[model samples]
Target: MPVSGTTKNTAYTIVASSLLAVCLAYIGWTWLMSSGNPVLTDVVLKLPLGENGFIYGVKDDRGGATVPFSYRYYVYRELTSNEQIASELKTAGPFLVTRDPAIKVDIQGSTINVSTNQEVYEYHSSTLFRHTNSNHYTPVTINLCKHSSDQPTK
Candidate 1:
């Protein structure tokens, strides 16, 4: 027996439809995974060592405002030898209390920049004034939080 033209056409249609459906599903899954996390692609942190200490803030590349996320300050002493150097320090709070609520800071490269709109706020850590050594430094990490009202001004 020979197959009819109608049957052949129906088989081709079914294969084509199945392939199209699979492609659409794959595209949808990719979109879902990417849209789950809002990431800050470009961030700049400016930390100018002022009379008080270091001023911290972040420039929002997305053209919104940056708010203080979280920070940890520590005090360390230098332990160095002819070949190797280490530090013995006291670790302080990854403090939840906002040091300056009105001020925001972001990490850009190696420096943390403060917002210019407000007066330069001081980062108060007891060890901040203790030493000016390379081994004695502060490490701060920040995350850019998007607000509901943060829409592009333009």
Candidate 2:
């Protein structure tokens, strides 16, 4: 039994439409789940950690004229197995946010020290855990506007 040309065309159209709908739904879901809109700023710092990896900082432009800007930090490294380095690399973070415009990062052994205007935050390389089979790490967010004086009123 041979199928008609019109019938085959209909089937193809149905499959294509279903796939398009699924893709659109997934995109919408991803957009909805993300936090507030943040644009990557021009500020970036890099600290080399041997040949295997390095630590970096990227600031996000989240605040307007009334609110202070926020900065985020990250660490990146090449995956290794059996003492062999893999082409693929992994990243973890935006670990925390700071309001300082000029932040400094330094690496001492496996520990990364971040210096801000008010304080210094330290993160150990061993404690950073990227999701299995995924390059995303569990992010930590700290509140910088705890004091009423820092908050911007509407």
Candidate 3:
């Protein structure tokens, strides 16, 4: 037997509703997952790190103006040898984060010095939220010879 027009319409409605629900859920999930993390909207500075690496000073914005939701200075290290493409640099370590917008990073010999007016902040991410603490001194210095891990170093 052939299906009636009303039955066909009902079947179409059910499929459309299910698809719409799935799409909505996906959008909501994506937004909630990325809402707390800061987005790298702009790069403020780029400096040489040794001969094959680079130090980048970036502004991370969460689209707000207060702590935990504000724009901050974030420093990262990108090594050219780690990637297949020379021009496409991938940031390996998120070295530092601070409230001070102005940050200066310099490499002297085998040491990298990071200078900031405000205290350096560290992020501790739990299952649900992001926790931050000021646990570093200004003018932070790290010896390249001793630092090997990708973990953030003070």
Candidate 4:
């Protein structure tokens, strides 16, 4: 009554497969329960963000830009009007601009107002005063306008 090598190999394979399945199930269950939201899963896992190797550079064809392709770029932003862009550029040193309209933190200061179109200008507090956190990053609020989505409190 000797055990065959084929039988031993089959048993090993079965055990390995079962262990792998259990490990995968545990990981999946943990992720689903902790976040309770699949959308946040990508964020938690630090998924690959296809940001072009280089970002933030001024383009000549600027007409108030925003993210062109990827909406996954995670950063605070504000849109500047043509007039505001001109005025700010005078004082704002070497800052980069994507095709999509954007303002940098260095140039963006407190009490900013921009009007991209022929509409009334929107006043903004372009300072990182209120959203200031005593953490690794010093969150600066570039107030494109008081109407901005998350305008940092000044």
Candidate 5:
């Protein structure tokens, strides 16, 4: 015997409703799990340089000794302006100055990696302007700190 049109429609509706309910439950579970977890913010620095370029005096939040607050730092190469470079350099302070023999930077491809005595930081290159025809080098420094409210010392 063949199934009736009404019966087929009812079966289809049941399947669709069950799928929708499952999707809603999954979404709710994901939200609940994420809400309880801590969220971390990242700070990035971009430095533009040609092959064999060098950067010095790179430090981590822990006075260049250890990584702090689980923050991941990066330094890469990208297009930048003179004013912006100057501002970042000033903000980064004399540590970024190459005068320190302890601090040394080596450019590998379009990225430069900065490392402390204990940890090494990986740098990322800009996908949008990685291959630009400019020969200028710009150092971008990013600092990641815990929110004042979240910090226990504060």
Candidate 6:
């Protein structure tokens, strides 16, 4: 007698194969779904977080602590005297930087170099400044709170 090669359980094999396909699909979908969210450091790096929203500065070497609004606040003014600017820098490091961090980014060593984005200030005790390297009438110390304006009355 001779034997035939056809499987008797072809239907069962097909069903099993189908189930395995579905399971594999589900596993792949879950893997894709689970791989989305990242850690806090990634979010911080991708987005521009304001001073308050961020707990620490990743840019700074010391893992800089968040300073109060008061410390970050600055005011700047110009004067004809370079000596006055020097004196303020001696007393305040950050205070000097905040008021006017540097020249207009493009106007370094140029005569037209003045603070580019001029927001009105009310004047406070603290101010920052830079010298024109040419002009004496440059701003000396501008009070950070100098531009302070009272709330609009109803």
Best by lDDT: 2
Evaluated at residue 48, the lDDT of candidate 4 is 16
Task: State the C-alpha lDDT per candidate.
Answer: 0.37, 0.52, 0.49, 0.32, 0.39, 0.30
| Per-residue lDDT of 53 in model 6 | 16
TM-score of each: 0.29, 0.43, 0.43, 0.28, 0.29, 0.23
**Per the 3 Å backbone cut-off, how many clashing residue pairs does candidate 5 have?**
1
Sorted by lDDT, highest first, which candidate order results?
A: 2, 3, 5, 1, 4, 6
Alpha carbon deviation, residue 14, candidate 6 (Å): 0.6
RMSD of each candidate relative to the true structure: 14.3, 12.9, 13.9, 16.7, 13.6, 20.4
Where's the lowest-lDDT run of ten residues in candidate 3?
A: 123-132
Per-residue lDDT of model 6, residues 53-136, tens digit only: 111111111123553111122222332233443333233333212222122321122111123232422223332243334333
Off by over 4 Å in 4: 36-154
Q: Candidate 4 residues 88-120, lDDT tens each?
A: 333332222222334332223232232222122
> Candidate 1 deviates by what RMSD?
14.3
Residue 135 in model 4: shift from native, Å? Answer: 30
lDDT of 1 by residue, 38-154 (tens): 222221222444322333222212223564332222222222331111112112222122323344555364344333232222343222322345444555333323233355896
Q: How many backbone clashes does candidate 1 have?
A: 13
Please estimate how well model 5 matches the true structure, expressed as its whole-model Cα lDDT.
Answer: 0.39
Better of 1 and 3 by TM-score: 3
What value does the lDDT take at residue 14 in candidate 5?
100
lDDT score at residue 61, model 3, on the 0-100 scale: 59
Clashes of each: 13, 0, 0, 10, 1, 27
For residues 31-119, what per-residue lDDT tens digits would candidate 5 score against the true structure? 98653321222223334455422232332233234524323322323325534433343333232211122323445554444333332
